[model samples]
Target: MPLTKGRLLLAALIACALSSCQTADKPPQPRFTSTSKDAGSATTTKVATSRYFIEFRSRYALSYGHTYVVFGKLDKNGNMISPEVAGLAPASHDPSQYVVGHFIPVPASTGWTDGDLEEQYRSASWRVLLSEAEYRDVVAFIRKQQAVSKTWEATVNNCNAWTGEIARHMGYKTPGIWLRPQQFITQLRQMNTTG
Candidate 1:
């Protein structure tokens, strides 16, 4: 059949319009589906409504027989931010031997210059040794607490009334300890620049 240019153009437009209309009127399709028979089956999954902050601890050894713990942060303020824990030990080598416990503050003037083994031992007042397994447990504890404190307000819901409570609850001591505000902020800045 012979067709005019106008007729062909009109047919094309009509077909396009009909296809778009059909698509627009169709029902919405689900993106995900469960194969399980039970609605509450173990395989069935639901998206979590809440999220948590996270901290990481890399393994490190101390001068003495103790494992050093260094704190790190993974999530904060709806962003995935990983920051190292400054001025702390990461893991101990011989935790059992260092019964005095771990924690020896190095003087800024000293500049980490404990040259001799004897000198380092003398300077290290506390004797706390941590095995690799114990150190892992501590790191896990820190991560768990970080997850719990999603918001500053929720953290303040506790008595400490501070954003660092999550870190503290995991085993933070006094000034300049793990996850202190100044130290954490410093580490965060370092991480940002390094990346």
Candidate 2:
């Protein structure tokens, strides 16, 4: 028997669920970049300092997608070292929790959920270098957020919101959280880069 429209849709959803958080496409190159400037001394000499960085990233996923942050200290050669990841998502791996989240809130898990390390799935990213003080503050704030954030809802509170909080903490303007992960990350980069 030929499959009906409803059957096809069901099959698609099931396939998406099974393949969620997995992708085959190569990771997109970093599309946005920002740097922090150090002030010169009264003697007209500039001091060198180590730079840390926070990267707001988006990746492909089952539904609209996912957004998260990767942050760490940068080496003298400007490479990330021991990057840390954080994001919010349904606590349960069961697909039902994600489905229920669309209509109501579900328990959330913050910090290093799946799809974080798979570079191929990354859709967008914004990297901002920070001062030592700023890096400490941002890391502390992320830890506090992870401790307090308890729930997830698709429309009200989700991955975008999680990253938005971090962006705001870093003094960057944020876009609407309702956008797809890729769009949200792009807008966030554009907004801060221009102003």
Candidate 3:
């Protein structure tokens, strides 16, 4: 039997759900590329009072969207210096990995993923300042999480859950994992910011 319009729409939705973190646009160059000037200044005296921060972020993607964390030190002038990103997604750009991820665990990547830098894709963000001690602890936790993160399953081990673990480590309350990335990030900000 020939497929109907409704069937076609349902199939499209299913495909989108399976290919969760894929983006249609070609990945853009990162905004914070190191320069020769920066490389030459590596031996400068360390600032006595630097601010560190972790920004929980959500961005648009092919599926429900993505959530991640950007963290690093900031100068007294509030300029970022060598920020790092971490998130969880299927290891391969191949759609099959995302498809299988919905059923069985698929290999996952815990470092920077697509849409981390495109400002236009950002939906929500919550940035929290950290003391040097807190920053060290959080960075260590993120690195350890990256080292151990092995697989991705849409419902069980998706991006939201990964970020939630980081937020919990920082002593912030996280919304439930089932929420869309944008909603989860927005609620996270509201829940943690209010006294």
Candidate 4:
């Protein structure tokens, strides 16, 4: 082979090596590769252990004493659910199917609407921090509740009841304070000393 050809090949190899080194210095982005199986495609998500908060809310000002609770993962900046939404529509605007004057345990994530929460939430928060194992345990508890029975009562068996059950299962205390959503969840928070 000619000397010039050999030199060109060596230069190309050096450039490639330097470029690869540069790329390795940057952090890799999370990638989702989808695969088609049968008639549908599925994308597997990276299941990193996440922390969740049991957001406790209070009764709305004009809601005639109503409250609720929900679970949410802490965001990248450590933000959990907030019950505050300024100037939201009234509870009577588009009454929540699961929250308004009723007592039923709905899935925390998709149970109520934003307006429903803002209209009813007075001012309180009960956040239960969860490890990965605790998160799974809490999830199973929720699933069992979902599979069983669901009944709603006017002021008796309501969303606070749902959160109370969750609090007990999560190894917290529920000292029979079932009516006031605000106070009940505050007790749960006080009991969540470990997680």
Best by lDDT: 2
Q: Candidate 2 lDDT, tens digit per residue, 120-156? A: 7888887777788888999999999999999998767
- Predicted candidate 1 versus true structure: per-residue lDDT over 1-195, tens digit per residue: 457887897677556433422311112111111111121222112322212222211111242121122322223232223422322221233444222222221111100112212222221111112334544565565555444433211111211222234334434332222232223333322332221
Query: How high is the CA lDDT of each candidate model?
Result: 0.27, 0.77, 0.74, 0.44
Residue 130's lDDT in candidate 1: 30
- Report the backbone clash tally of model 2: 0
**Model 3: per-residue Cα lDDT over 75-158, one tens digit each:** 787666888999999999999888778767899999888778678888777666667787899999999999999999887789
TM-score of 3: 0.74
Q: State every prediction's TM-score relative to the real structure.
A: 0.21, 0.77, 0.74, 0.50
The candidate that achieves the highest TM-score relative to the unseen native structure: 2
lDDT score at residue 192, model 1, on the 0-100 scale: 25
Candidate 4 total steric clashes: 1
RMSD in Å for all candidates: 27.9, 8.0, 9.9, 25.8
Candidate 3: C-alpha lDDT: 0.74
Compute the lDDT of residue 27 as modeled in candidate 4: 22
Better of 3 and 4 by lDDT: 3
